[model samples]
Target chain A: MSGYFKRKEKWHKKYLQKDATLPMEIKVEEVSPQMSVIIPQGEIDMGSSGELRDVLHKTTKNKVQTIIVSLEDAGHIDSSGIATLIEALKKVEAYSGELRVVINTKKIFNVFKIANLDMVFKIYESTQDAKNA
Target chain B: MQKTLNESVYIQLSSNPKMATFLRNNVHKSCSMVGFDEEQTDMIVLAVDEAFTNIIRHGYKMDFTQRIDIRLKIHENKYFKIILQDNAPIIDKNCIKARCLDEIRPGGLGVHFLYTIMDYVEYTTINERNALIMTKHLPKKSRTKRLSSVNQQLLQTLLDIGRYVHQILDLDTLLNVIVNEVKNLIQCESVSVLLEDRETKELFFHTVLDENKEVANKLRGLRFDSNKGFAGKAFASGEPLLVRDVEHNPEHYNKIDEDTGAKTSSLLYSPLKVQKRVIGLLGVKNKISGSFSEQDVEAVTAIASTVALSIDNAYAHETLQQTIPDLSETNRIRKEIESARLMHQATLPQALPSIPQLDISAVCQPATEVGGDYYDFIRLNENNHAFAVGDVSGHGLEAGMMVSMARSCLYTQVNFSNSISDVMTAMNRMVCGSIDKNLMMTFLFAVFNTQTKVMAFANAGHPYPCYYQAKSDTWQLIKDGEFPLGIHEEFQYSTHRIQFDKGDFVVLYSDGILEASDENKEHYGLERLLKLLGSKKWMNAQEIQLAMLRDVRNFCESLFHDDLTILVIHFL
Candidate 1:
């Protein structure tokens, strides 16, 4: 059973494609030396989640004290998209940095809720709301 | 279960990232057209997106110019099916497993979403294209129209064959797959792919398949000119030809049927072209049913392109693998020969012996390759001096080492004994004992007594030395034919005596001088050497030596193929 799971893991790694960039538009805005905001538009699924991860990884590596991800314009978010946020959240917490996400759509929020990561991350109504908090 | 209206739509898109939005819109419209709500449509659209992105990222490796085809079909307003196809190497579909979503990772989620949203998802390959077929169980709705499904089994068959061809890199296996697929598709009695030898341009039977095993076995070894048969006509014209009756056709070449003992009733020949150049011919013989048709010609022509591309790729791969090793081996041998050349140069006579009665001059010019040629002058006592000119057979490191070994043995043996025969016998025994029979040495050993004016010399398969007596004004070659050194161990070597007078000359040389060939392949033989020496007899030893070398150079304009060494002695 362990060997079967290992093979299953290999299959996932093979089929789950990753690229240097994604198709959607992603904007990174700097608030200060230790704070930043990432705005991703359109669908954040398998095809575009890689770009989201790239932005989040850069912000975490820069040792930002507070990183805000705004998903107001995103129409859809799949499991891979949710996993990208979870991965970034883990990196930010490791350095005692704060990661806050602002969701305006119920569909994209439901994806995070379905993955049970709504409680794992700091969710707000908007980027301004999260920055004020 | 009642069947209702069947609707199908086909869409083609380039493998570009921006095309994702266009594809999503079409898939979403496709779901609603089948009477699905917005929420369920989004789930179905996302699944199709994931599958398409996987094809672009992994299958095409993100080449945006490649084409992708999608077929959306709704069956009875219940079963919605999507088939996506792309021309890529066939990957094993069985190994595709959705990740266990328990592990929170950035990847492995696209496949999970695919498996969760779709009712039944499957992966397959057709031709050289990877295909993903996903089916979703639609919510039941009221509809009462009956329709028939489109027949595309032929397309599937071509896809299967395309997959087989591109997946195999080995030329032999690819040719076999081609023959088997052609035979199965056309239902022919025999199939063969005769590839032209790129250098010879002769068509040889690379793969042959026949129901009659004996005929197939005979045809496997058969080859002929590519311009002789109906197949040749197709190859020459770069077109497909279908002959319904072989006996009635004037272009039919019956040599293959006669040689293989198989009757030729009909033949269909298609030229396999890659990049507009015909590489080979694909021929099918005697259709199993009635006769060949235009449809059969079209089918064969279609697959020939795929076959030609695969064969060319395989040939390129095989040539690359072969060339790398050959280059490295040549480099290795070249370095060894260079080192051997340095070793050969060190073992030559550094300075000629200086005596009051004799003027000795010697020159040993090495060739490009390491040639095992050596000459030495050793003073035995106050009045007598021993000298030798020898050549080891063959070239490179082995021959170089043999010359070095013989030099050491000659030096040791000449010191112990003054007899020319004793030094010759000892040198022969040492060569025979140390190395194998393939390598041997031709040596001429001579001891000159300056006081008595007598030259005693013995030959071991070496060319006889040229002797010019000033008194007789005539040249005589000291002739003796004996086995070269490293042959017979106990063979007795006899010494020949020559009385020298004032102004006498004797030339000791290796066979390279006598056998040197010009551009016309004519050897600079003994007659040329004698004439040259007679003309330069008035000059001193060194002058005559240079004159002889110049004459040989004039005879052969190119570089000498072997090592040339000459030792000259003039009685002063």
Candidate 2:
């Protein structure tokens, strides 16, 4: 009778907690010598974690070893996003690659410390700087 | 309401030590009505006498012709609001910081007494009127456990967290201080830090929370090496892991929990990062009995970041002073102040909402590292827009962060589809969970629907903002709201709604506007605000903001000690 998921008496999926669309997307392109990357924004939680993982995995299809995960635009994150990064790092390391972070706003910088992932990543001051590095 | 509400009586006492008795009686009577006890009565009297003595000796220099206005009519809840409207010995609200009780002496204790005893204080000079409004209510002694305000619990938690560390600003101390604050704030059974070793490429135990035990026991010498368990993952990935049901979670490590005899059920951890580089893992394990909320994560993150930045800033300043060898203490304090300022800026206004029908501008000018005043704009929905401005009962960083807590509650409520009244109620209820019972805040919140031209608002013991008429060019004061948050939930905020035709301006301000003082010790009162609005010198929000600030600056020669917040809204 409904378009989305409907529940039976035995199985109750709290309707209020249903998954929704994400506001962040990891868009990478091997466009010419000049590069532009669109990293995730908002909370990098489990909801957007898979999409990010898949995007990062696919973005490496081209043998571009130097990639950037620009986080200056990102406001928050959970462990799932960190996991996705770890997975991406494994793939990048397989080809001797380098993943850099762009922190436009230092607000996101401390978030890395709170998550304990600051040591695991190579972060730069800005996207342009990350690209240069 | 037009001719009566703005009425205030000023009485200046020059060299009247005995007037302190009368001051005590009058204030005590007003305070008793607002619920002060005999002890509180004595404290208020002492504070007033010291103030009166200081004024008589220093301010007027025995200038009897210059009167200090003592207006005692108790409205806004039978609370005694002592308005020392004087042209002598003006008190600077900026100097109101928490002095170490160890520095307790008699000579300069007037401000300290006023701060420690009274609940609220504001100093301002409008059109040459030096006015100080000191507001306070006696703490409910009989019903300690029965009542709680969110602000009280939050401040209490901060204070508790602060208790573990001798001083909050002392970062060169050790990780023991950080762990102690975390343990106190989280009410955790135990706290341990896991830091990544650069040379060894391994994680080792750094500190522990044996706060009540002893200093030597603080670090416990515990180590959980690489890939051992949750702490290791936390160390490896540099992320906080909360094992709510630690016994059930596959990744939880119970060694530390077993060692402490702490049943590992819930946890909250934050990573210590410096410029996006994780230094280590700091966590509170086994939260008393419940699961931690997202707010817990955010709060831990905030505290951790503040610690990291302070440590880094101190380290840099120390290095600069040594290597460059020309840096001054002022430069060091300035850097400290700047980083503190950055922390405030980073926490505020991530994005100014581009609401479809709203053009909003808001600003926060703190007198110091943190101020007691705050005003925020939060959109509840498409049509229902909410904004709140408030001042905590005291001054300083503690009070400022409490204001942040109130703001966060409002934001969380706004995010969860909460209405204005619901938001206020939730905020009040939530304050009791973390703040101390001693602190309270005066707040004003409102919602407006542009299409219907209806504005709904609630005021929690805050100064009334003036609602303006573009056609008549007259200001109408909306002075009907309830007590400040953390006072009592039994007091409900009365939501008043009115439909505007169009082009009406609404001006909201802190008590600082009515109380800004000049060198002559004269204050800028509400009549002046009405005059400014009436003269048509300032038409819209921008003009009014600039003009009012200009007038206050001219009145006091523009040097402000207490914070000033002025918000204006116009309906098109």
At residue B448, candidate 2 shows an lDDT of 80
| Model 2, TM vs. native | 0.36
- Lowest lDDT sum, 10 consecutive residues, model 1 chain A, at A13-22
Q: After superposition, how far is residue B127 of candidate 2 from its true place, in Å?
A: 20
Tens-digit per-residue lDDT, B479-569, candidate 2: 7787778877555556788777667888888887888887577778898888877775343354566456545644654234436777777
For candidate 1, please provide the TM-score of chain A on its own: 0.81
Give a tens-digit lDDT track for model 2, residues A1-119: 11111211111121111111223555565534334364775545433556777777776655466878877656544334555776676676778877777776544554444344567
Alpha-carbon RMSD of each model: 29.9, 29.6
Candidate 2 ranges beyond 4 A from true positions: A1-133, B1-338, B350-352
Model 1 error, position B362 (Å): 0.8
